[model samples]
Target chain A: MNVPRHWREQIRRYRLVGSKCTDCGRLSFPNRAVCPKCNSRNNENYQYAGRGKIISFTNINSPPKEHKYNLPYAVALIELMEGPVITAQITDARAEELEIGMEVEMVTRKIMEYNDDGIICYGYKFRPIVEYAHP
Target chain B: MKPNKSVGIIGYGAYVPKYRIQNTEIARVWGNDPNLVPIREKSVPGADEDSVTIAIEIARNAIIRAGINPSDLRAVWVGSESKPYAVKPTSTIVAEAIAATPFVNAADWEFACKAGSETIQACIAFVGSGMAKYALGIGVDTAQGAPSDALEYTAAAGGAGYIIGSAKESLAIIEASISYVTDTPDFWRRQHEHYPKHGNRFTGEPSYFKHVLSSSKALMEELGTKPEDYNYAIFHQPNRKFPLEVAKILGFPKEKILDGLVSPYIGNTYAGSALLGLAAVLDKAKEGDKIFCTSYGSGAGSDSFSLEVTDKLAERKGKAPSVKSYIERREEIDYAKYARYRKKIRA
Candidate 1:
């Protein structure tokens, strides 16, 4: 079963949200209700600029039954500027285009969905944030 | 008189094979759509990989991670229902590979998914009794069942290890533990069968949830702790969703269960799942924080424990393989390869 195109697109271009701990000053993606460090319920309001660096990655040529849409895609650990590591799909780049500590930014995208029902699931992904020279 | 000797983690490690099999391709091959099972990818064991090799790998990492001398270990125990040989002691092979000579007390344990935690508990008992200075508890398996068998999507490969000793003499301390046992047959693998038989609905209420909740509640009550006190909660996950539902019922919030939820995407590593999730939580958990863990096995039993983060745990974060590092180190195997490995198709 194939994921609906729209969800794939939505997830291909998604945004990731996270919070930084005010106590230990560590970053947590997807937000934490309590600080794992100091046990503080008080969260320091911060959204990841969605920009990060790749720490490591792998190309998954095979996925699970529910994730038919994704094949031969790069899954990586992205270190957000906030200091927490995140696992997400790397887009707009092939297997060879990635490296450890490479700069990246989160993007919105469609991941998988109920194909026949057309219920799409969206998620945040990372893409290489390349620097370009002003012509 | 000295306080009850607290058990501590003296060594630790884990193993995830290089290959990954997509759940979707597996569904397609089985004449069903991917949606039949909500799985993403599963770790595939290599040609040479088995319960024994995986345990050895984790044991090596644990030894390296703990920085303890192999000869210092007095006992070795390998825990898994997926043992490679019927009569051979897998622990002996693991001990030899890690160079932990002449095991004073070495054995293999099996209790379905709870085998790993059970080994830890046994090691704790051994070390606390002064029968040994250091004992190794390793859990590793490459669980297999037929495709679209409900077990298919989540029966992945992985393993975890822990070295136990005195608190003053080790890594993470074991604060308290409680266990509950019942004779409910939620899951069972016969004398010579590769796959387990499960009563799904029965597993949910009468077995998995029941025993885990009973044991965890008893542990918390005995320790005078509450659900809100834990920084993280690690549950024996047969899949990603079961843990969350169990947590919700137990009054733990979603955030408390997120780290462990990674198993759904990674697939059910059986004995490795809960411990691996705990490893991930420990990576980011701070000193003095508490972690509540529960382990469940299919013949129906659970062991619940209260764990507090120690200064030692903080100092040892980067010393071993990081959870993210292990998850990223896998090679993806397609449906065909998965079928072959599962032995669904004969060579």
Candidate 2:
């Protein structure tokens, strides 16, 4: 990706800023301009809580050209708490450790390097949420 | 220097990569004895992790612990030696990641290893002067060491962050601080140099020890306190031995430095070393306890602070995961896998 494209995706990439349909209460990632489900134009900017579960995942042993450095990485369909499903790369855990319905949280990470001397694109990734007990 | 408005750490956080490579693995790769390892294991950032990503994780934890709106942050400072880009400021990325943009002053700082502590000093000054209600200071790095070099054993990745504000809203109060710097070139990395070079034993006497000792003594003398007066003492740990030796020389018992001597497990986090140690100590310290912290950077210099735990510390302790939890939550990898994670070999 070039500089402009990286800049354009910054808000959704960093803050999990998406769109929630006011008419049907459906959440959509990438901050959709219109609701996909109900074909409603009534949508508000929504910020996801970033808590989600792994719906399905696949191990990318052979990655894309830009991401070839990270071999055998996992990409997953995450069902967010706000009722939107988004596809993202999973990190901080091995492929063997990932399972369906595992809880995860969003974290910012480098998505890919554009070239040897070009811009580096960064975006959100998911990590398993280890349990922390509070009294 | 004592802040006029009594500024202190309102909240703190730390982040170490989940991937760790055992010292034995490095020793095996370099054809050396595992017994000669300086640390047990060192954190390694994944292919997608860098200084900015690490800072964002720790900053998020600090924000959670501070229990304040991200927009409340008036400034954000990140100190590191291994920023992702040379010209662009890492602080801007961090500020935007934490959603503290548009009105906050943001910049990147470099002072070798002590840069993180420098961020703390700047934050204290900003809030103490009442120019900002809150400021975030982060010391983070994905430090680089040349392959098979001695620096490889201990130059690791990790960092800690602090949110500084009024003492009234703090879990711990900074009573005083002092800094000692000189034009010593004990360690340095030139422009475009991928890895840093050190002056062998030169980094020891005329740099690390001298600066750390001078700064710590000066802060203690100014505060009219003794080694025994502080409940805990945290010194920059380049290895397991440096902090212990410094503690003994300064008349502090080994037990006082135990909680903060974290380099043994995480390796030297460069700018993050001493500050991470202080965070670990704060994780277990009690109210009314005193802590003496001194950080050494290789250029070289030291920044020392004397802090006192407050009654509010207990309430804030559970706001985020403790330093111990981060350390305990690790998954070790072998040398080949480590090399891939660190990008030691080109894809």
Candidate 3:
């Protein structure tokens, strides 16, 4: 929540930057120093294009202290089209409407704001791509 | 004054948050009939969205439509009144999000509704000077409306982004642009104020209409063009009626401006108002089509522009979602959720 820690992970948080194993061409959702597939240190930074499908989801009614503002929210495990799965908070849709395999796209949003004067953390969240088109 | 250099909108994009609250819903909470307000519904930002996020989405779409590298953008200028931070720059955040940081002229602008067009004017000069190949101008806002006030029915969340570059690579050439401003205290919000105040009846005749007509007529006169010459016209819409009324006064028929009048569907996006209208028109324009646009801001002024669609427009436009697409991808929300999203009910 402080400056240095939040600032250091901004690119990964904002852009969904993950690591791709250069050895076996496998991708990891959160970038790690070592490749998960080949156990090799050779990895490349791969920025996910932010579009994917919801593999699974959960409805959170009792949230942590900071997230009490959003009384009921949905969190989903999304499988990015490029082959990495990440957990993200879903927006613009209610929990009752969510279903497995619903398509979604990432958008930048405020993760949390401690207070009016405190640092606001911005990160990626996914929204349903319902009745949407890409050309 | 016409710039010596030929600058035009090479790539353009627009964004509207997916959630919408009907005017009837707001009226229901206030003990009034919602059908009376000009707009049918208004777009609302989700709890996590703000001017910065809206601008980032628009800038990303513009980058896609422009088919240019983010590194090639020489500047990223964002114009808005509903900035997330009182001190930090929205432009820098937008630039960094689009990966255009490190070598760009970035800044924030304010002029109420016309703030976005003000960026267009600045971008014209930036690219006209030949300082860079491309620059971006975006008008965005998560407009604030006091609970139960009339402005609440119309002030909404949305944005439009445009990429300005050489005429040769442009989708729409900027033939001419001019501004008309005056010392009018028609609408304003003081420091620390949560919402804006308007001079009611005075916001019309003396502020919105006067400046819009004055700048629009002058721009046409300077270009030596008539209303009949333009294939399309766009005007600032504070509601469903203002733009149409102004369009009629300017001698533009109802049909020419209808395609671009997005306010009736999404409410007034403040800084994004007229710029979003223009973006809608550009989405379907054909080569050689002429478009005239005018944007008005409270405090109060109007920025007018004349543009012509180029051959590249038809091909490059489809790369990103159209304004119509953003408008249609909506999910209606009740007043309770809307209040929570806008944070009207503080814990």
Candidate 4:
């Protein structure tokens, strides 16, 4: 029940709070302490809306032991509207329905739980926006 | 009783997950039963969604519509039966999520389905006493029913949140309210039990209808208003038939109740039943519209309110996503996915 890591990472996971270098206008996800591009220590918390399109995606017909119950799920690399790319499991849509450029949005979901009686870790996941943005 | 201070709802929000499990899918898994009727569909929480995350979404949406600084809220209360942790406080997490922490009184309240209303009543007192400028009351649930019980057919996930403040800042002023309770045991879940148990057919007349009718009548009689005076009516909808039937008995037309009877589409979200219904009606109500609401909880009691919409509602009803939007964006899941998502099966 003591997942201190879960507690520390909750803010970034819950609200998609990333990092942006005030010096170089560089953006980093997972709330980095320093700028990855300019190596600058000046940074601020950047809240990403988590709206963007998929760069690539795949169907996971086979999964790891803990995720076998959720078969035939979709995983994708999404470029956020705030200039960050992250890997996430796509939900609320079938694999065939996902296209390379299809739009997506973030939602908070259980990423992992230590055990039935233990701590549940929640994180952000992207789901496809069925209504195309262009329409 | 009339509150000494006039407290009103400055903002309200409702959240329903995108996933849905049709009653047909449920019937396919467990053949049609005698009791399963009128509940056509139900909202299902995503694999990661729980009462806490649901509460966060509800709080954020409410904050957007409230147009008040979250730090200004002095109290945050959550009412639910399906709390994620037995020992932890859901209100603290919700308050933190909305950036309203450290300076707030946070706690969880429980009264089966009427838990949310109980918190709302408390917030009414909190603001009415001038202890705080505003307080947040939330009713949410991600309740699970036993695999093959009657509760499984309609137990659903959803919630709504409200921000209570002075009448000058409110979208609707709570003119009057009344709560009627009795020592009736129609439904309950024992400590450590995974699901709730109920008295078959006994939950209807003795519990739901009795408390709902009594509270509604007491509030209306005290105010000297009739059902026709209200432009809209919302009831705790455990099922479609119950709300429609109860409204008719109270002399409310179908047209006045249909807009808020969301159980047919999303099932009984327990504590959220009446709060979500209130949010839905608020999205459509105009200035000067009078709204009647009543919430019922098994074991057993009801909370009724007579609210009048104001110009503030017309100005901010569209600030956040509407309840209709969440209902419109529905994705159907098969029983297998439903079982996995709902944790009826472990990976």
Candidate 5:
């Protein structure tokens, strides 16, 4: 929650910017320096397309101390369009509305308030994608 | 102000918070008739959302609609009255979030409700002059209104963003633009003030009307086009009535104004009002359609632009969610939940 820690995780926090294995073409969130898929060190920076589908989900009715204020929130494992499955908070919908295979898109939002002085942290959250009929 | 080289909106996007606070709920808490409320419902940002977050979301969609890499964006400008931090620039956060940092010029702008349109002017200037190939301009706000105040009924959250580039690559071409300004002090929020204060009826005639009508008329005269020539006319909507009255005074038909009348659903998004209205109109406009947009800000000033839709508009319109969809996606919340979401109440 401090400035240094916040700065360090900014890539993953913003835009789901991560790493991709150049050799095997596997994507990794949190941006690993090494690719696990091909066991190759040949990795390149990649930005996820932010489109994905819910693979699984859970409701956090009882949250930890820091996240207690946001109780009853939903978290889900999302399979990105480019093929990386990552965990993220599901927003703009209730627990009952969530379903497996629901289309979702990444949205930037406040993650938490780090301290009383109001140093807030921001990150990505997923929301259901509303499809519009083309006119 | 017409740019030296032609510049237009290559792409555009909009974001409205899913959480809505209905007028009836606000009226219930204030012991007033819901029928008297200026807006039917207003958007409320979630605990995990703010002006910066909203800006980033819409900017990403704009980037997508532009069909360009985020790094191609050379400038990022955000206009808002409800920026997350007063001293810090919201533009940098937005640029970084959208992966446009390190190479882009970033800044924040404030001109009350007209701030967003001001960004549009700057972006057009930046791109038209070849200072940058692609510049992003956003008008977004998580507007604040004092508890139980009249402003609370109409002051709401939402915004829209546009990527400005050459007319050849544009979805809508900017034909002409003009601005009218004066030292009108109709609305203001002093330093450290939680909510803005207005000169009541003073915000009308001398402020919104004077600036919008003059600017719109000037742009039309310069373009040699009349209200009848435009397929759609969009004016900044502080309330449903203001834009309607302004449109009528300018000789634009009600049908021309209704397509862009979004404040009734999302409240006045301050800097985002006019831009969001433009987005709604663009969502439904076809190629060859002419549109007139004018924005009013308290200080006060108005920026008017004459735009012509391009064939590219039809192809790129589906690159991102339509403004109509964002409006349709909603979940109504009660006053207490609205208070909690907006952080008016501490947990």
Candidate 6:
């Protein structure tokens, strides 16, 4: 019923990760219960994109409660350089600077915070690649 | 098996709620006159209804119109922006209500007004791929916006359903289809939200007229047909005037588009406007006639198709609920009734 924390982190970092059914070559975004392309329940294989281009983006002036703190945030549907388009929040640029087809690299960052009885809950978000520091 | 075969519309039916609120009534509620709203009357849903319920009613009517048992359908798809629940699939509830279970495919789809038509197209693709036999596409909504807002007059209630597959046993043949999509936020609503946010003038000329007209032109050109070739050109109606104005701009004569403006009377059903207009057209269309349809959705996209009326049209003519009858069966409610019907004012 919920996406796993690291899987959520993989997306927040713009790792361009998805599950590729070893049984069938069907690509899944945010993983899957089974391969819709092949109906295979064994989804053990996971892959990452690492790079993509923004297909479309929207600057949300008024967002939902889950995203209330990130007002004037940018949500983009990015077409991975490898395959498939996925939706995620854009990072590393002001709302005014984002445009369609802009090349971006995924970086891991804090996404959202939940106030559960005064305990802060943090989640992952994807930041744009402006300067990639080699490890 | 691949259902790459042609799936025509075997049966069709529509339902618009019986409460009609005049523009003057809305204007009066807002302390203005009728002309202030400029639009005409709009149909309103009762307290017991939601998009899922209305869709079920239409699907039931469609099954009846097609002269088939509801249990025979293999797949069901409900297309609407105003779904009853965001998480659970509304299609499952509708499928269970209409008894279209033990089937492979059933889901709720979103794309604004074009959702239903797109569902039809997807059903056709699925059936053609041999994945399904009969698929039902239902579009229904009680689209709500803030009272006294401009959208209040046009966001209305109604639904349309189509059972697709087979020419020998179908009501009409889907001759051709083309879709055009653009990334633009002309109109949208969020989860658990009652009101829709729109870009006003951006919804019309730039998004709707632009995408619909472009797709219609592309379809016409591909088919080597002109605007005059079609008996009617139905668009995802936001109001009474947009259809006429767009039709005129595209050289489709005035008469060809008037009957398609059912939204001015029934309000905008989100996904049901175009197909419902086609239902109105079917009530009068002759055998061997062609109907050009261009359906639009906000966030915006358009699906244009050509349908050829079949000989079987006469069999279901008077049996199913007619557009005129639904219009006549309505009861005029006062502003208070309207508020109650839309759940805008608390009891």
The candidate scoring highest on TM-score is 2
Model 6 accuracy (lDDT, Cα):
0.73
Point out the worst 10-residue segment of candidate 6 chain B by lDDT. Answer: B1-10
Candidate 3, which segments miss by more than 4 Å at Cα?
A21-24, A130-135, B33-35
Q: What TM-score is obtained for chain B in each of the predicted models?
A: 0.95, 0.99, 0.99, 0.98, 0.98, 0.95
**Candidate 3 — what's its lDDT?**
0.90
| Chain A TM-score, prediction 3 | 0.91
Candidate 5 residue pairs in clash (backbone atoms < 3 Å): none
Question: Which stretches of model 6 miss by more than 4 angstroms?
Answer: A1-135, B1-4
Candidate 4 segments exceeding 4 Å error: A61-72, A129-135, B33-36
Q: Each prediction's Cα RMSD?
A: 17.1, 1.5, 1.8, 2.8, 1.6, 18.9
True contacts kept of each: 0.00, 0.52, 0.40, 0.18, 0.58, 0.00
Q: lDDT of each structure?
A: 0.74, 0.90, 0.90, 0.87, 0.89, 0.73
In candidate 4, list every pair of residues with a backbone clash. A110-B48
Q: Summarize candidate 6's per-residue lDDT along B1-347 as a digit string, tens digits.
A: 12346668888878787778888888887887666674678888754456765776688668877887767787899888876566778787677556566554788888988888888888777666766677788777777767878888888888798888776777788877889998998888877667888897888888988998998989888888987778877877888778888888889897887766687677777788888888888777767878888888988899988888989888776666677667665667788877875667653
Model 5 chain B worst lDDT run, 10 consecutive residues: B338-347
lDDT of 2 by residue, A68-90 (tens): 87776899999998788999999
**What TM-score against the true chain A does chain A of each candidate get?**
0.78, 0.89, 0.91, 0.86, 0.90, 0.74
Candidate 3 all-Cα RMSD: 1.8
- Model 3: per-residue Cα lDDT over B29-87, one tens digit each: 99987568768999999888899999999998899899899989999999999988899
Cα deviation at B301, candidate 3, in Å, is 1.2
Ranking by DockQ: 5, 2, 3, 4, 1, 6
Better of 1 and 3 by DockQ: 3
At residue B181, what lDDT does model 4 achieve? 99
TM-score of each: 0.71, 0.97, 0.96, 0.92, 0.96, 0.70
Candidate 5 lDDT tens digits, B1-347:
78899989999999888889988889999999878888889888877888999898789779878998878889999999997787889999999988888999999999999999999999999998999999999999999988888889888888999999999999999987888999998999999877888898998899999999999999999888999999999999999999999999999999999999999988999999999999999989999999999999999999999999999999888888877888888888899888887778876
Q: Model 1, range B1-347, lDDT digits (tens) per residue?
A: 01257777765777676678887777777877777566688887754356776786688668767878888898889888887677768787677556686655679999888888888888888888888888899877788765578788888888788888888756567888878998998888888776788897787888888998899888988888899988899998887778888899889999988865657657888887777777667766777888899988888798887877677875666676666667766567687766665556643
Model 5: docking quality category: medium
lDDT of 3 by residue, A1-135 (tens): 588988888888877888888898889878989987789999999878899999999998888877777657899999999988889998877789899998899988888877787777788889887353532
